[model samples]
Target: MKATTVLAVVCVAACLSIHASALSPFGVGRSQLHKKRWWSSVDVNDLHKYHLDDDPQGYFGYLTQPMDHFDPLINKHFNQRYWVVDKYWKSKSHPVFLYEGEEAELELGEVAYGHHAEMAQAHGALILGLEHRFYGNSTTKEGLLLSELQYLSSQQQLADLAVFRVFAEKKLGMSGTNTWIVIGGSYAGALSAWFRLKYPHLVYGSVASSAPVRAQANFEGYNEVVAASFADPIVFGSEKCVASIRQGFSKIEQMKQAGQLAQIVKDFNTCQDMTDPNDFKTFASDLQGTFMSAAQYNYIEGNSSSIGTLCQQMMVPDPYQALVKMFNPGSTCSDVSFKDFLKLLTDVTFDPGAMSRQWFYQTCTQFGYYQTCDKNTTCMFLPEVDLDYYFAWCKGGYNIPSSDVLEQVNFTNAYYGADNPRGTRVIFVDGTIDPWHALSVLKDLPEGLKSVFMKGTSHCADMAPNDPDAPPALKAGRLEIEKIVSGWLMQAEMEKKHK
Candidate 1:
């Protein structure tokens, strides 16, 4: 492996690993949409939020991709969808910035990040956001089953990006002349950095915000970070909240251990009672999964809003009171029971799993980044999950064998330089507040390549529009990134002239 890759791995020796929904990451829902129903039953409308089509002349298009990118000679094609906007620019002479999409579906989220649109306008650049294959409207001819999902992989998606770049240039009659910069956060951020490295000729630079470049096979640190986020009295609002949560966690553990099934059922509000240890473990994982999901995307500040309406519910001084608030924010009239909570969750969530199967499949096959808890650890969670359970989920959910997942992750780490990514003109950004930030690149890279640490931010905090309340660190980081990208544009032009 490369020296950089080795150093990165050693630093973590271990460690672990989405965004744009408000308080959530993918989309926004109106208070009216839920209709006082518990757990917002996620539907196609909930799949993505529709942005106003008032500016930038955004439109959608499709590209034909091979069924199997690795063996393209014999495979057929599928129409993969993408969207682009080019209205706000100095001129066609500016660099083109590609906002890489994430695992979720998207028409696109609001791209009002601090000065990103301004930078594009100032530089006369074009901006295009490509939906990842198997997401949004992108799909294969055979449709979305494991049989057809075999065509899905980052390698395949990256190739689609390369082809899209070529197609885009030809479509705009600006072939080979425009400098290209790629930007994205979360999984999309990972793609942005990876794309530049793999297709250096096609990309001039990249801004990989909150990217977990390394593929962690055993991602135990995920929940630990979540615990740290809540347990910190300084960052989170109340120590009482933290203490109460801890108490509740202990309560649950004791209940599970002593086979206090009645209390366990009453506490979480499960749809069915689980007596079997294996069944109980699944139940435990689901309950904790809500909390884990919240921390991963807790861009709002304190509280686990992503888990439900957690932070909003956290207004109460007591944790159990807050838990009631979390599980039932709309129903101010009365407390919601745990069983009712299950039914509400089934009806309302866009995906009860908290993620699309496409992403889960990718995680199982390529990433292995589920937030499993550690045994004998006090991370405000139970050790109900590990590689065994995760692999079992993969097998059960996607019908994929777990034989090569770890091997594939190892290969990915080696190939991508793990933390030590090999590239120039790439800026890696991670926030202090985000749990995944630990897996992201924070150290300086060689020369034009660098890292930006956004202090007191969460998830794709940088991806959000200019928030006055945003930390000074985030603002300063944006300025530095802007300078770097501007310099890259100039550099690419100079290199072109020399050539």
Candidate 2:
């Protein structure tokens, strides 16, 4: 794809922008108070005005970068805590939550800003974090009303980016002239690539870390990819570990079949530094975390044997800590057990009730070329089995999908990708040790795309750990990025230069 062609695609996409309806239940702003950061209340009345000052008692505003469009009567809304509500209300405004490496939000928008900031700071770029639509303060409403929260989708999220750019440029004082780079890991990384494909004019460059854009969204298909990677001798070091893994998985599968899935999971949590918990909350949380950790990585290899091998490594004594780090990083786990670790691998739920499961189903039936009715007024998923249920299960809770998300709202093109004359640059950073490295979208990335395969990380490379200059190898790669992106942006700005 030529640079000129890429620029044209971006421009054309931007020309087809959508604006949020001011009267929608989601457009009003309200505020609330909290100790850490003040949240605005959700306004149920007017949607055009964005109120910032009506915060609840005891909350402090945390946005370091000031916005001029902020209004006491109308711009910002508050909640008990914006982060939690911001996540729940996504699909309103693109919400951005900063976790500071402690409480990581799994939402794609939050990760994008966090990862982008880390990378921008490393490269000495002036990082102005932009929140996505239906998230954070960017929502059309004051708070997350269960009824209004159902419209979240990738396409809506992308449209929100254009709306946000207009808002940020006018309120946050950015000139769209400035180079905007989109960065993210895992699902968000996939979004970054999709964003460029969808709205090239808004982004100057894109960094997609540990890309997970798969052709099919089936559990069996995803696991096959992971199983194949594990089968590769180079990734596993030895055939013995492979055989042991096979035996372990057979036993684990038997446990699941025998109705001992929950027990094996309980024992695994008990091994996590052995602190006696007053309730089963910690155990359940740990089990879900372990399960997701394994499920996300299952796409790297092609079968059960490879997954079995990976599980065995988590139980061995010499590399136990390493395994723990791989499976459960940033959390305490000094006393966890082999059974505990095994539970994590076997914990994946392919039942329609699981979110990851629902995600694939909803996305596949709608956008994987299956073509159902218009997604705007009618839905492709049945009310009983859908992504909401799956998401609830992942959070270890049950959140009934209200009529809000059950409506036939369009989410089909939310994360779709298309080839363009302007060959889009797609960078995929994978941590070698991160199990997810096995099931990335790099293989499916459009033929002419540019990519960066970061060594030693699960997601995208934020920056090099010890030497902040992005490590030597990344520095070299980014140089090419700088040249390519700078040239592309300059071409867009200068009509006569490339002609």
TM-score leader? 1
Query: Which digits, one per residue and each the tens of the lDDT, describe model 2 over residues 393-477?
Result: 2233213332322221223323353222233655555544333344344332553366555432222333212223234444454
TM-score of each: 0.80, 0.48
lDDT of 1 by residue, 3-46 (tens): 00001111111111232221122111110110011112223343
Q: What is the lDDT of residue 143 in candidate 1?
A: 46
Off by over 4 Å in 1: 1-54, 108-115, 237-241, 299-355, 376-378
Q: How does candidate 2 fare on TM-score? A: 0.48
RMSD of 1: 8.4
Name the runs in model 2 displaced over 4 angstroms. Answer: 1-124, 133-145, 172-176, 214-216, 221-237, 255-415, 418-448, 454-457, 462-483, 486-499
lDDT of 2 at 323: 32
